[model samples]
Target chain A: MKFSDFICSKAIRHELSAPDKEGVIRELTGALVAAGEIAEEDLESIVGAILKREELGSTGIGRGVAVPHTKHPSVEKLVGTVGVCADGIDFTALDGENVELFFLLVSPPDRPGDHLRALENISRQLRDDMFCKFLKQAKSAEDIQTLLDEADGDQFGP
Target chain B: MNPSEANKTVVVKNPKGLHLRPAGVLAQLAAAYDSEITLTKDGLTVDARSILDLLTLVATQGSELTVAASGSDAQQAVEALSHFIANDESDEEE
Candidate 1:
C-alpha cells in the first residue's frame, strides 16, 4: 500500500527531534493524537502497549527498518505512522543494525487479518533496496510520500 | 525445517488459491502457535513464523506449498494450519 492509503501528513515526521526510544515514540504518537486518529487520553496507553510488544520481540527487522505494531481495544481501525530519522537511532534490529525508517502500527484487537495484511504490505515493499535507499535520503514529508508513491506503483501496481 | 513436520504437507486446494488473501489467512493461523513455522515453495524456505516472511513466498494459484511448525504445539499447529489451508473460501477473514 502507498503512503496515501494509511499515512497522513501529520504521521510523517521528516525531522524527528526525539533522541531516544521513549522520546521518539512520544513524538510520533503525539502526532497521531493531534491528527484525531487516537484520543489524547489513549496516547500513554498506546505507547505503553507498543513498548510492551517490543519487549516481547524487537520489531526491528534490520536493513534500516523497524515496524513497531500493537493491537489495542481502544483502536477501532488500523492506524499507523511513519517516521524517518536521518540521524538514526539504536533500535536493536535482528540484523544488528540501527534503524532510520520506522512504521508504527496500531490496530483494533479484533482485526488480526488487517494488522497482518498491513504489516505484510509494508514489509514486502521495504524489501526493495533501491526504495529503502530513496526513503533514507528523503528530506521532507512530501519527498518521503513521493518515494512511497513511486515504490507503491513499481512494487505493488499503479 | 525438520522432515518430521515435512511429511505433513498440503496443496493449495482452494479455488482462489493461496494468493495474497489466503496466504494472509494461513499466516494468521501460523502465528498463533509458539513453534517455528516455515513455508517452503519452489525450493525456497520462508519463515512461516512471520506473516510478512510468509507473504514473501508469494504463493500463487495452485502453488504447492508446505507449512511446517516445530515447537511444543507442533502437532496442533500442523492440524490447525492444514485445516486453514484446506478450508478455502475467498472471503474468509482471519
Candidate 2:
C-alpha cells in the first residue's frame, strides 16, 4: 500500500488554488481526470460521491490533513491524488482545524480491502510530523512526488 | 488486568467494517473520556483517540477486536467503546 501504488503522480498539485472543501475536492478529482487515471465523464459523479461521503462526516482527520475518499464503479482500481492548500480549507473536522493536505481517493466499489489498506498506509505515513511538514512545503508536483517517493522509501523517520 | 484497567473483546458488526465514517465516529467517541484507550484487532493495537491509528486497524466486518482502557474512567470507557463497536452499524449506506 505504498503511496506510489495508488497515487497518480501526475495528478499531484503542490499549490492548490481552491478556497474551500468542495473546490479542493473538485480540483484534485479534475487532476486525476487530467492525468488519465479516471475517466473525464466520471469526474462529476466521482466528485458527487466524495462530497456525499463528506456529508456523512468530514474526512478531515485533523493535523491539518484530510483524506477524502469514495468507492465508485467508474475506477478499475484505486486511484488517488494529492493537493496541498497551503492556506487551508474548512472541513468541519473532528479536531476543529482547517485542512491543508488533501489526499483524495476513488476506487472500484468491489475492492474494499485495497481501500482500507490505502487508508491505513496513508495514516501510518502521515503520522510522521516531518512528512506532513515536507508535504506542506512541497513547491511543485515533482517536489511533492519526490517527498511521496521518499515516504514510500521510509526516508522520513517515523 | 489491574483494577484500574478494563478490557473487552468485541466483534465488528458494520457490513462495511470500520471505514472512514465509522472509524472517525469511534475516534470522536473515544476522545470524550479521559482514559487512555486502545482498540486491538488480531495482534495490532492503536490509540483509540486517533483516527489515523484506528484506520490502521483496518478492522473489517466480522473482525474481532479488544477494547482496553486505563484510567479512573476505564470501566465506563471500555463499556461504551465495546458497545459501540459491537452494535453500531448505522453507517450502512442508502
Candidate 3:
C-alpha cells in the first residue's frame, strides 16, 4: 500500500509543535478532523484509543519514528495522518530515542488487512535511507507529499 | 568457514498476528544479542533487528516463521525470539 492509499494528504503536517507524546497524538488526530478525513465527533475517542494503545507500549519503533495506531469502531475506514516534529517528542520507544516522524492511524476494528497493509507499506518505504532522510528534511506539507508521491511512483526501493 | 548458525521454526500464537507491539518486542530482543537475526514467514524473510523489516512480513496469527541467527551468540538469540513469538500471551493479542 502506498501513502496515497491510506494517508490523508490534507492531514499531513510539517514542523509539528506538540511538545509531548500525548499532545502529538491529539495534534495529529485533530489534523485528520480538520482535513475532513475523520469525523469531528470521534476525535476524543480516537485520541483516547491511540493513547491507550501507547500505554500498552510505545509505538515508537525506533529510528526516530512513531506509528501510533489503534483499531476503533468509530472510524468506518482506515484513516492516517503524518506529523513531523523537527524538535522530536519523547516516545519512550523501544530504542529509547525521541521520535520526529509520527504516523497516527485509526482504522475500523474489522479491517485488519488494510491496517496491516498500510503498516507494511510504511515500513517497507521507510527502509530506504534516502526516503527517510528526505522525509525528515521536508519543510512543508507539499514537500512531504511529493516525497510520498515519489515513493509511490517507485522512485525508492521495495 | 562461517560460524555455526542457529535456527528454529515457531508458530505465532497471538490472535492479532505479529503486529506492532510484538514485532517491536521481537526486534528489541533480537538486537540484544551480538548475532544477526532474521525471521522468515512463508518464503519471505526480514531482519529481525529492525521493527520496520519485521513488520513487512505481515505474518498473521497461526502463521509459522523460522527464526535464524548467526554469530557467536546465535543460539541464544534464536531461542529468545522464537520463544517470545510462540508463547506471546492473551492480554496483548487484542
Candidate 4:
C-alpha cells in the first residue's frame, strides 16, 4: 500500500519531455518498458487502454495531479511509475487545472482491491501540501525518490 | 455557529467499499447540502465533500462508517448519505 512498495525507482522520471496527455502517457509507459517492468510489445496496448479509460473521465483529480490508470491483462501484478512535468499538461481536470504530477498505474484485471489500495495510498500522501510542493520542486529522479521515501516513512504526518 | 447536528452509523454494503467511483458519488451527494459533512472510520475523519479525502478512508467491505453532518440541513444530509453508503449501486461496474 505504500508508494515504494509498487513503484520501482527505475520507472521514476523527473521533468518529463512530453507536453500533452497522450504524449505523457507514452513517455511514462516507455519509461516502464525501458526499465524492463513492461514488455516492449505490450507498450502500445497499455497506452491505448489508459487513453480509453480517460475517455470515461479524466483521472486528473485536480491539484496538479493525475492518476491515469487501467486494468491490463499483460500486467501480472500492479505496477506504477511517477513523472514530473515541468510545464503542465492540459488534462481537462475536474477543477479545470493543468496537471504537473502524473502517477500512471497498470494492474491486472483481477486485482481491484490492490488498485484501490494503491490509489488510496497515493492520495493520502498527496493530501499533504508540503509533500506536493516538494515533489513539484524536485530536480532529479533521485530527489523525487528520496521525497517519496521520506513521505512513506511518516516524516510528513497525516 | 449552528448547533443542529445529526449522525448515523452505516455498514458499507458494496463489495468494494468506498472506492473511487462510489466515493465520487458520495462526494457529489455530500456537496449538494450546505451542511458540514464528514465520514469517520477507525478514528480517521475525512471531509465527505472531497473525493480524495473519502478515498483515504479505504473502507473495505462491511466496514463501519459514521456519517455526521452539522448545519441547517444536518438531519437530511446525514440520512441521505447514510442511505447512499448502505445501498450504493453505482459502483457495480468495477
Candidate 5:
C-alpha cells in the first residue's frame, strides 16, 4: 500500500523531541492520539504493545530507520505516522547505528497483509538514499508529506 | 581465486509466505555466509542480506524465488537458504 494512503499529514512530525527509543515511540504514538486516529484511552496500551514488540527485537532496521509496529485490537484499520528525529536515537539497531527516521504502524490484529504491505512500502521508499537524505532534512510536516508524495510518484527513480 | 556461483529455484512453503519475520530470518541466514546472495522473483532481484529488499519481493505463499549466490561458500549458501525457504517450519511467530 502507498504510504500516503495511511500516513496522515496530521500525524507527521518533523522534530521528535524524545531523545531515546521509548520516548520517541511515546511521542509518535501521542501524535496519532492527538490527531484523533486513536483513542486517548488506548494510548497507554498501544504504546505498551509496541514496546513489547520491541522486546522481541528492536524494530530498528538500521540505516537510520526504524519501523516500530504492532497488531492491536484498539484500531479497526491500519493507522500509522512518520516522525523524524534529527538528533537520532539509539534504537539498538541491527547495524548498531542510531535511527533518525521512524515509521510507527498500528493495525488491527486481523489485517496482517496490510501491516506487511505498509512495512514493505515504507522500506521500499526508504531504501532510496536520496529519499532518506531529504526526509532527514525535512523541517515541517508539510515537507515530509510532500516528500512522501514525490517518492510515491516514482520521482526518486526505481 | 575466483569464487563459485550457484543458483536454485525454491518455492516458498510457509503458509504466510516470505513475510516480514521470515524475511528477517532468511536475511540473517544469508548474512552469515561470505557469498553475494540474491533472490529473484517476477524479474525483481534484491540483495539477500537486506531484509528491506527481501520484503519488497512480497513473495507470498507458493511463489517461486531463484536463490543465487557467488563466493567460496556459494554452494553451501544456496543449498541452505533454498532448503530453509522450501522446508522451514519455524515461521509461526517471532
Candidate 6:
C-alpha cells in the first residue's frame, strides 16, 4: 500500500501531456503495460472499467487530486502509477477545480485488502499539504519518486 | 446469466444500512473478487467493481440488496460480499 511498494518507476510521468480523461488513461495504461505490471490486452478493459466507475462520481477528491483505479484480471498483484500534470486537466472534481495529481491503481481482481490499503495510503499521503506542494514542484520523474520516498517513509514510520 | 441465478441474495441488515462507510467496506470486499459483480437495489443496478458506483447505491437500513457475481469465480465473489455485510464492519473507523 505504500507508494514505494506499488508506484512504477518508469510509469511515473512527472508532467503528463494527455489533454483529456481517455487520453490520460491510455497514457497510464501504456505505461503500466510497458512496465510489465498489466497485460497489454487488458489495457482497454481496465480503462473502460475505471471510466465506468468515474461515471458514478469523479475520483477527483479535490485539491487537484484524482485516484482512478480498478481491479482487473490482467494484474497479478497490486500496481500503481502516478502522474503530475503541470497544466492540469478538467476532471469534474467535487470542488470544481482541475486535477493535476493523478494516482492510477490496478490490483488483482480478487484483492480487496490491497484496494483498501492502496486507498488508505493514497488518502493519507495526499492529506499532507507540504508533500503535495513538493510533488507539484517536482521537475522530473526521479524527483517525484524521491518526494514519494520521503513521504512514504514519514507516513509509514519506516 | 439471469442476475438472480448468479448468486443468492443478501439483504442489508445493518442498523444504519449501506451508507458511505458500509458501502466503502462492501466496495473493498468486492475488489477481492475475480468475477464480475453487481449490486442491485431499489430496482437499479450498479457495478460492484467500482467503489464509486457502489457508494452511489446508498441503500438504507431495511433496504434489500442483491449481490450478484458472474463468471468462473461467481461463488467466491458472492461469499466475500455476503460475509462483508453479515459481518457488519461498517461501524469500524477507517
Give the winner by DockQ: 1 or 6: 1
Give the DockQ-based CAPRI class for model 3.
medium
**Local distance difference test scores for all models:** 0.71, 0.88, 0.87, 0.88, 0.88, 0.74
Give the 10-residue window scoring lowest on summed lDDT in candidate 1 chain A: A149-158
Instruction: Kindly report which residue stretches of model 3 are placed more than 4 angstroms away from their true locations once superposed.
Output: B1-3
lDDT of model 1 at position A76: 81
Residue A49 local lDDT, model 6: 86
Docking class of 2: medium
Chain B TM-score of candidate number 3: 0.92
Lowest summed lDDT window (length 10), candidate 6 chain A: A109-118
Error of 5 at B39 (Å): 0.6
Restricting to chain A, the TM-score for each candidate equals: 0.92, 0.97, 0.97, 0.98, 0.98, 0.94
Model 2 stretches astray by more than 4 angstroms: B1-3, B91-94
Q: Locate the minimum summed-lDDT window of 10 residues in model 3 chain B.
A: B85-94
**Chain B TM-score for the candidates in order:** 0.74, 0.91, 0.92, 0.93, 0.93, 0.79
What tens-digit string does per-residue lDDT give for candidate 4 at B2-91? 659999999998876687667867888999999999999999999999888998898888999999999989999999999999998554
**DockQ per candidate, 2 decimals:** 0.13, 0.58, 0.60, 0.52, 0.49, 0.04
The sequence of per-residue lDDT tens digits that candidate 5 reaches over residues A42-106 is 99999998898888777788789998888788898899999999999999988899999999999
2 versus 4: better TM-score goes to: 2
Single out the weakest 10-residue window by summed lDDT for candidate 6 chain B: B85-94
Clashes of 2: 0
Task: State the TM-score for model 4.
Answer: 0.91
Task: Please write out the lDDT profile of model 2 over residues B10-49, one tens digit for every residue.
Answer: 9998877788888877887888888899999989889998
- Give lDDT tens digits, candidate 6, residues B1-94: 3233366567776655554345655666777766788988778787775544664555555567788888777887888887776657343221
CAPRI-wise, candidate 6 is incorrect
For residue A30, give model 6's deviation from the true position in Å.
Answer: 1.1
Clashing pairs in 5: none
Question: Tens digits of per-residue lDDT for model 6 on A1-158?
Answer: 57888898888988788998878877887888888888788888988988876776667766788888776777788899999888889998755798898889887865655665666567656666788777887899999889888877784321
CA error at residue A131 for candidate 6, angstroms: 0.5
lDDT tens readout by residue for model 3, B1-93: 346699999999877778888888888898788888999988998999888999999887788999999998898888899999999965552
lDDT of 1 by residue, B18-80 (tens): 534455456667778778777787887887655456655545445677767777777788888
